[model samples]
Target chain A: MIPNNISKLIDAIINKTEAKKAIWGKTSRNEEFKLFLEKGAVTTDTWVENGIEAIDFAIYNSYGDKIDNFVAYKGDDDFDILSRLHNTAKREFFKVDETIENLFKELNDPKSVGKRQIEDDTPLPF
Target chain B: MKKTISISIIGVVGIILCIYFFEDSDKTLPNYATVIGTICSIVGLSIAYINILALKEESIIISKQIHLTLEKVNQLNSLSEISKAIKVNQEIQEFLRNEKIELARLRTLDLKYMLLHFNNDLLLNELTSDEEYKKLILDFGIDLNSLNETLINSKRKVDFTKVVKNLEELSTYLTKFELKLKSIKI
Candidate 1:
């Protein structure tokens, strides 16, 4: 069965992609990547959401595609696939060690991080 | 994985109780008379109140865990986005360099051997040499040094991966936490 969190992740990807036009403005490159990723052999939901094609491809290949991409895009096989996987195992962690360090800077900056206001209906994975 | 499953179980129980309480508020009770009925009523009310309290606690716990997880996921997503943006631009550069290299390789060959070399598949050492073909092979070797750089910066930016791990740790710390978040009773 699809785990609820995983299901929610998948849903969020689709929903976000559907709304990207309003979030990030138009880009021809984004459209090009979108087309390649939509049909590519990989888990493309997130890439489709973020309007980033190569990421979609990388993610697809990383999860386990034959990975017949180019020399350029393939992740550095630092210590073979296992090492890479292990290294990436904690790739998503955000420790936030210095919450106070940059709050003032962020407040002053015009280009603040645009926090994605996740939908109220979207169930979070804990 | 284990922690999440537990929270889900607990959450399901709480939800079921809520639903039942709402739906059967005035349902008929099995007959018991006088003092016995009164005693049972008091006990039952206390039990109900305790259950309500439990449900509320579970709900609060589930909410906190969910928020933590979401925050982490968002952080990781943002870092990945930045990494990807760098990669996309880097790939374009690699594509250009690959084209230059291929052109130089072909240029060095005598015109007489041009078609022959083309047929020999040296230009296509990877694939056929066309504008389209070049685009396909020219990945910008961004993984070499770029990914490390991304990881470092993204770490500073708060990689969501840590949050995912932390959530997994906390949720699994107790069976109750998992049961509640996961909505799985057992």
Candidate 2:
């Protein structure tokens, strides 16, 4: 079973994609944003104080540019990694939602072995 | 049968005793108690009969569910096996297509790694001694380990649907891949 947070993030992405018909439409041509996405996560700092953990993460672009940084008062849960990633993609890419939807569709596709089919298996187009 | 015979004997004896005693004795028979007992017995037997029939129906449904689940498991097993084969095939295809390595060197590296990974000793021995294998290795002039590393590091986007389709097709060919394990047998 997918964790609740991850599932919610996927749902958010799917909703966004369905709202926008195209996957990476022409309007979202932000090169800096694309580079930031490609760079992924850069650095993470974690510490526990008074039985409460605090965490911070710095994100970067491909060209060594700092795109965004986040801090979680609750440590791990604060990261909200998938949601952050989804939001970032929404800001950066035009039709990233659709791409994400398609990716999830394939990942959850019933034809794949050992994968739980979220929906009924439809015959492939071959 | 024994219960029925015993009940019949008791019933006959009871009727004879009732006739012998009640005929000579005063007062009418205790009709109220006997009527109540008969009604209670009838109600109890009806409930038991209904319960038995319900249980039999329930058991049949559970048995059918078990059979369906077993069939699903078998299909999943076949799909799992075919999925593994498809993954290996896709990885190889991707490596060969994307890597800038020489054809002979790449094939040698692929064969070596595949044999090692799968632990196919018989295939390993045959291929290692084969003239083509030796010729390719010698002609390429590349270390096997490094060549394998190059293939491993080469990255490519894999189409998930394509992989699943390939696996489905491979599963369909299980009969041809091994005679003992026919599709129908699965």
Candidate 3:
């Protein structure tokens, strides 16, 4: 059976991943978030003796830069760490949405458009 | 049978050495026959001991291989269950796309039940003791729960696009997870 804190950490990681998917539409490039759980020194073949040590959650931007990271050790409170990371993710997502909205607005504004004419010198065979 | 023969050989050699030593107490210097017998007995005991140790080591290696194979089989079993669940999820998505709410709802319920059974099976297996594997199972359950809630909330007016998107995400996640499980070298 999993410990209570470890269970909470697992749930938090799943929740964060789901939220990212909800916002970014399931693409790996868009969902640039990762949660890594540290485990004790144990062979991969022996699952029964594995132990948790820490959990780390990281968020990255489209440019592949790390924007935020949250780490929680074994003794730290899982809920507090997760909530803080969740709020940061929420804020970052809003920022991206706002940027996209502003870009669309700029593209749609008629004042930002400049008309251009193409002059073709080659004669066409009719 | 090999071990038994080795042990019997050692026991007979030990008994012969004991008899040879006890019977030659009267003579100060040992005869060539007794010396030759003792040397042969020593050689036989050494060979038998080495053979026994080699057999023990070979058995240990074979047992470990069997254990690793069993672990891989269990992981593959879980991956197949996930594959089945992915198929059902696709059918649910199709039903939703067609606006067959009743059919989709039934299928959603079916999927929820299927995942419930899968989760229980994972918990029962030793694989759940692994942190990475447990997280994968938990993530899968969370996605299924989200889909179930979305389906249940919107009864008459279903969000076709949203539900389909969720199903697609779930399918993609499951495929990646299946690959991850397959990549695990036991």
Name the top TM-score candidate: 3
Candidate 1 deviant stretches above 4 angstroms: A1-126, B1-33, B97-186
Which ranges of candidate 3 are over 4 A from the true structure? Answer: A1-126, B1-52, B109-157, B180-186
**Candidate 1 lDDT tens digits, B79-160:** 3433443343333334334533233222222211322233243212332333332222111111211223234433212222
Q: Per-residue lDDT tens digits of candidate 2, residues B1-186?
A: 344455556655665565556544443467535644665565556566666777899999999999878866754554454345445545544544554345524444443343233222321343334443332222122123224323454321223333233333433343232332233332
Task: Name the weakest run of 10 consecutive residues (lDDT summed) in model 1 chain B.
Answer: B136-145
A1-126 in candidate 1: lDDT tens per residue?
A: 333553454445445444432121111121112112322221211112123222221222211122432211124321133222222221211212234446767878898576788899998897
The segments of candidate 2 whose C-alpha lies over 4 angstroms from its true place after superposition are A1-126, B1-30, B73-77, B80-84, B100-182
Judging by lDDT against the true structure, name the best candidate.
Answer: 3
Residue A13 in model 1: shift from native, Å?
Answer: 41
TM-score of 3: 0.40
Report lDDT (CA) for all predictions: 0.33, 0.42, 0.53
